[model samples]
Target: MAHVATWKKDMVSEIVKDITENPVVAVVDLHGIPAPQIQSMRADLREHAILKMTKNNLMLLALDEAAKQRPGIDKLKGSVHGQCAIMATDMNPFKLCKKLEATMTPAAIKAGQLAPKDIMVPKGPTPFGPGPMIGELQKIGLQAAIEAGKIAIKKDTTLVKAGEPVPPGVAAMLPKLNILPIIVGMDLRTVFEDGTVYKKEVLAIPDDYYKTMFATAAHDARALAIDISWTTKETIVPLVTKAFREAMGLSISAAIPTKENIKILLAKADNQMLAVASKSGYKSDAIAARLSSAAAAAASVKPAAEPHKKEEKKVEVKEEEQVSEEDAAAGLSALFG
Candidate 1:
């Protein structure tokens, strides 16, 4: 049987040791990243994680060996493809993914490289002066115009849609325009934590989005617990407070006076009585006195100083003016005759 190479054995042993030591084991794609950038990333990540680059077979073997001790460590084997590396960290998988995402730096797009997101040429004056560059820009579907003796993008134009391969023309023109549309960094593929493996999709959550979801979930959980009257340490205080409020409200409504609601109940009863009395024309002494004073003032204002005396005239009637009934009847008979 052929023996394993000494270096391979050493690397496999080292990988096993790392997987055993670190709580998190991740698979990362290091394709297209330059060696200098890789070294820089290694240094940057040295504080929180350790990066290991080895042959895929060696990595698989190491994982298989390590899996004996750590139950799910070998699950990272499925993600081991295409210029991959292993990262061992004490940090949890989610935090490690976030840290890696933060280390990304914008890089110029390469020919035939797919855009990670919409690539737009901004509307502004470029360093390029008026020349054939305008035709070149126009050739790549960018609106270019000559302004102030310099070349400028007429408007923001989408040169490449996300998931679409960048054309050679657009790729060549981007560098001249100083447009960096590609973000280059170590891409984490998968992570093994304890006995579980989490994929990139699972770990790639925006920090704010995750926090908002978690907060909303926690609030909903609390509300549901209170709604169902579930007893828990978290719900206890609010539950007790709510119960006390409801009980107090019931006591007030029933007029069962307690220390907390006695004053409120009395004030409520007093207000009701005052309302009833007001509607029934009942008035206090002060109000009655004010009304009496107003009436006296009105009477005094009406000519009390002059003393109004109505003038009288006698009407006279003569007794001779009265006609007898017999004379009236004789006059009526003479007229008829």
Candidate 2:
């Protein structure tokens, strides 16, 4: 008894240390999770973060120690028994949470398993054999019968309601049908990063939803950064290049916009169209015309193209030929040649 107590104490201490150091922990309720899927989840999570499957008591003890930094982490005190997995990560917590939710598969329903959400068995045709078992299925609101020595649901049926207990007869049949509606994983979780505490809701996002949200947020942030001149290399390249070319134009009376600057300016200008519209409200064509006129003027006033050395050589040869013909007529051909 003393040995067992000591072992438990040490185990609790280890779990506490993990949660403390990681700072981001996900409490997954494994009550309805199948053994095979649980193993798969463990392997998948290891690729991106750490998953610890331990007793709830141990996890509570760890949360108690780290409660000062994460005040609400102790909310996970309950729902950590039988089968539970703790996921920890330093990356974006929401992304990780969404990833876990995507792997849910149908499993045999078990007694005492809580439904994660509403379980809706769609109504459709059932194919059952005509037998005593057929009447049993019909009793439970299922259109089923014994046909061709096999039990077939004659039509679709709603076996159980969401948040309701699975009737004994239906529960037994669930294993054969392979349907586990409840997902057992972390419900309430938290993350502590850079001195900030993020709640489990932060990670409670769908993958596609979070992806779309982040993309829009990033685009908005970039646009604001450019407008405010707070842009970094990632955000400043286009804006600065445009400004640099504009400054160069002011230096040279040349009306021609350099080819290099054309792309740069166009990109910045195109991006800032909404801002321009908000300010001056001038149509795009008018702005483009003014820019084109300036560039063309610069090109026209620029120096003409100079003659190449080869062209000068050809001109000198022509002059010599004229002189040689005159010399030949005057009997000075030898001297000229």
Candidate 3:
């Protein structure tokens, strides 16, 4: 076998160490980004991750070596392409993806390069003074005119649609118009964690994606638990409260008197008696007021109105003044006469 340099072997060892030690390892594409920007990104990511650049062969070798300790880590070898760098981070794949996305910034489109999106020249004043620049803009299909001693585009124009190559003339005109039509950054390739490889599309998740998922899952879990009555720390209080409410409702509907619902039952019975007396031509002030209110409500028909929850008034009657339940039921007949 040909002799391999000691430095190359040491570099491979270092990469393998990073892959094995860090819980999260990622591959990112650095193609087309400037060196200074990459350095700045490294500083920005210093606290979160360790970005390292090495030969593709060295990285592939490192992946194979790391696969010994981290099974399936070699699956990341495919992401080791041109201008690739690996990062060792403690952040989960989702968070890392978000951080990586923040690195993108507007960059000037070069000649013969593919347009990232439709290049729009709006109808407004431009930064160029009138002269040959007007002709340059017109040559690239812009409706440019000289107004107020400066060149102004006459109408909104799309010089290049998305996925179309930036023609040489259009490319020359864009920089002069101060338009940066392309986005450049470190494009994340894959994330490796616990022998699993997460691709770019999979890792590209909205910031609220997990939060919304967790919230929905928690709500569903609580509802399912209540349905099946599964008891746990988070579900215990709600379950108990629900059970108490159901029991109270059942007692009231079935006229089964209990200490909790006794006062409500008495109030309900009194309302029923008053309703019966009023229907039998009772002319008392209270009956008149109740009837008028009922008529007003029936006329309006407010279906959306919530059930009115009246304040409960406790009346402590003396033992000598107390009336039995049967006497109260027949009490409305006396008011009717």
Candidate 4:
């Protein structure tokens, strides 16, 4: 057996222990990032994660060894290229991604560096007074002019386009214009959990995305369950309400009376009787008086609609049934909201 250095063994063990303990493990790219910034990021993430940096070979060895117990952690070794570090956290992968993204700060672009996006100089007053500075700005392709006794850009100028190398002259003037184009910090490459690897694009989601998705899913699920007449603790109330509505409609059609639907049924019958009497030209004084009264009442106000009524009554003479919206909402919120 080959003799391994004690420090190397300890480093690998430390990494292995972190992987096994924390549910989230990630490879973060550290290319072109300063040591001071790395220290600051480590401090910021101290509460939510553990970040470790060492030789890439040692990291690979640790991942390989840990995979013996973890099964698929070695897959992360593919992301080990470039200056990188291993991070372990108990936080979920999505949240960890956001946390890491939050650590990024705007950095000034350097000469010969590739521009990440279009750098625009807005048309506005500048700090420079009328002097040779105007000539310097014009040299950098900015439409500079003297306005209100101060240097002002004539129009918004594109200092650098995406993927284009920033010229030395343009780079020097960006700081004077207060435009920091490059985002500098620890960048996440891939995350590992439960034997799965999540890439940067997959983890980059809005903060409320999952919450919204879960809520929408819950709503669709409840709607589907109701459509299928499937009964569950969540769907029982709607199902019961539907059943009661159907039962009430059936009873009215068959002229069966119940306390809950009796008023609406009576009103409907009265309207029907009046309609028949008016069409038949009946010669009864009581009928005439009643029809006049109904007309006056109709002109003044309309009765409540049957479809919108939610007032609950006993399906059985002695048993009371009710659905608490607050309770249902609470339960659904606990489950999917």
Candidate 5:
């Protein structure tokens, strides 16, 4: 049997202790992050999480040991490939993912690295003066021309597509052009929380996305409750208002007169009577005089109330004026009908 190194034993012990103490254990890929940036991220996360970089074999062994007590913790070993680190935190796995994602910084594309997105050089003036640099630009698939004593890209050019390796010449020119096409950070692969393993796809959702989804679900639930007449604080008011409105509509349609609707019903009846009399060409001087007197009384009382009353009357008049010509024609047809 090979001799067990003291340092490796200590590392495995520390990892086991962390996993046992923390509720969340995550595996993250540290492939593209630079050393200094990783240190910076570690410092930033010190208060909330502890990140440990160790050999994959050591990490797998720690996870296996943790699984003995925490059950299902060993599932994280499936994601333990490439350059990886173990993150232990009491924070929820989703929030930990977001916190780590926030540490990402855009980095310039490097030779032999796959482009993270489509790289485009804009058509505009360059910092380079007119010289062999123009040929250098042209050599890397950019259309270069002399404009206003500076090298200008004649048209926007796509140097590389996503998932394709950046050409060495293009990668070299990208820095000169001040274009960064890659983002480097601690890319979390999976997490074990409370006997459940969450993958990147589950944890990558934005906070607002979950909020919106929950709000929509709550709204749908409230609507369903109101539909089924479920009595809860949230649904009661809207349900009552709906029920009242529907009852009012039925009462008006059935011509059932209550104190609340009696005035409106009388007004409708008056309007119908006027319509019938007008169609028959029958004019009653007594009825006209009474209506004119009533209008005068209403106008006199309205002005005496307050300036606000006059403004409200003006708004009412405007609303009446806004009735469509088609509505007026329909009313006329109803009168004859």
Candidate 6:
């Protein structure tokens, strides 16, 4: 017995030292794990984390010794009862926790094991057993009648709440309701890293949480890629395609005018603008040229600088001609006389 105690103490010391030195440690409670299942779990955890099973008392003692740096180390002592395993790793805690949950299978439930939450099984008809268990089934809202000397649940009735004690009646009806009171999946008890501690409840994340996280991360990544002009299957394909089409239109006299392509561009714009105009039956080029000529003529018809100069000059010349005619007539008359 003394030797056995010594070995246990040494094992506890090892665990404590390992935890303190390692930057990342995940504490897993192995309570209620069956022997075969534990073996399989060990194999599964081999690649991701180191799994250790130790006594509660030893773990508590080691944690007590290191209370200064790890203040809440004692809290982990409570979860070491029944059968518990400590999983330690340096990987991302949330991701590792998620992967661990994916490796669960159904198992039988034992009495006194705490229910993680309300245990619910649907209401169903119980098979006829004509046995003592039938009485228990009827108490929990299950219908059981004797038929062909066999006991089964005709239909499942939902279990009311988690942690609610399973009455003997309901326990007997388990065969029929197909309700197993065991938590078969992996439960993350706590995670510790970088002198900090995180409990299982906090890390007991849901599928949607990771889904939303990954989705948001993906969106941000795509936005960054676009900002840096890093084209990929995600960003460049669609945006580049749009840019290509726009550039082509600009090159083909179909977009805004520039000095190099102004004439052709304007011509196209003019044709398009006239398409909705009154149908004079004129070709697009003809209509544009006529419009251009009209604009030029309107510009050339600006008001003259001296508005009455030409009119004054014409009046002066007309007066001079009249005067000359008068003078000539006088001379002719005088000569005849």
Question: Candidate 2: lDDT of 103?
Answer: 67
The top-ranked prediction according to lDDT is 4
For each candidate, what TM-score against the reference? 0.65, 0.49, 0.70, 0.69, 0.77, 0.48
The candidate that wins on TM-score is 5
lDDT per residue (tens digit) for residues 1-337 in model 3:
9999999999998888887899999999998788999999999999989888988999999999999999998999899989999999999998999999999988788898888789888899999897887888888898888899889988898889999999998888787788999777889999998878999899787878889999999999889998899999988998999999999988878889988876566656656655665557667776566556555655465444445955332222222233355544554444544
Given candidate 1, what's the lDDT at residue 200? 88
What C-alpha lDDT values do all the predictions have? 0.80, 0.58, 0.82, 0.84, 0.82, 0.60
Residue 279 in candidate 3, Cα distance off native in Å:
5.9
Candidate 5 weakest lDDT stretch, 10 residues: 312-321
RMSD of 1: 21.1
Error of 2 at 337 (Å): 82
> What order do you get sorting by lDDT, best first?
4, 5, 3, 1, 6, 2
Per-residue lDDT over 6-103 for candidate 1, one digit per residue giving the tens place of the 0 to 100 score: 99999999999988999899999988787899999999999989899988999999999999999878888899988989999999888999999977
Candidate 2 per-residue C-alpha lDDT over 196-293 given as tens digits, one digit per residue, 9 for 90 to 100: 55665665755588689889999998888877878597777978877886676663334345664444333333324323432564445544453354
In candidate 5, residue 249 scores what lDDT? 73
Give per-residue lDDT, candidate 6, residue 217.
99
lDDT of 5 at 42: 95
lDDT of 5 by residue, 116-160 (tens): 789999999999998999999999989999999999999989999
C-alpha positional error of residue 63 in candidate 5 after TM-score superposition, expressed in Å: 1.3
Name the 10 consecutive residues with the lowest summed lDDT in model 3: 311-320
lDDT of 1: 0.80
Models sorted by TM-score, best on top? 5, 3, 4, 1, 2, 6
